[model samples]
Target: FLRAIGKARLITPLRSEGGHRRYSRYQLRIAARARELVDQGTPIEAACRIVVLEDQLEEAQRINAEYRRAAEQADPPPAD
Candidate 1:
């Protein structure tokens, strides 16, 4: 099933010199979520799409938080 996911272009695991697929921690996490969705009756393709969107949202949130922190540091509120 992981091969299917990789074929779907959802998460591409690295190919080792020995031709084995190597998954990263992040990729494994994605695969776990996809499996969970499948267990809940979600179609594999849809599950992959949902997982990708979820990851994108998480990254966006993290970047937004960093920007907010940087702005706050650059312009500390005026001391009363």
Candidate 2:
């Protein structure tokens, strides 16, 4: 199913010297999420797409938070 997930673009595992797939901790987490979605009755393809979108949303939110913090630092409130 990892191959299927890779083909679906949910996770991209690295290849070992012998061409074996090697997943990082992050990728494993993605796989676990996919499994969770599947257990909830989501189709495999749909689960992969959801996971990818979820990861993208999380990254966007983190960046947005950082920007907000930096902006606050640059220009604090004018008065109490």
Best by TM-score: 1
Q: Which stretches of candidate 2 lie over 4 Å from their true place?
A: none
- What are the lDDT figures for the candidates, one per model? 0.93, 0.93
lDDT of 2 by residue, 22-76 (tens): 9999999999999899899999999998998999999999999999999999999
Local lDDT at 54 for model 1:
95
- Candidate 2 positional error at 6, Å: 1.9
Where's the lowest-lDDT run of ten residues in candidate 2? 1-10
Model 2 C-alpha RMSD vs. true structure (Å) is 1.1
Question: How many clashes show up in model 2?
Answer: 0
**Clashing residue pairs, candidate 2?**
none
lDDT of 1 by residue, 1-80 (tens): 89988987888999999999999998998999999999999999999999999999999999999999999999999999
Which portions of model 1 miss their true places by more than 4 Å? none
TM-score of candidate 2 versus the correct structure, residues matched by position: 0.90
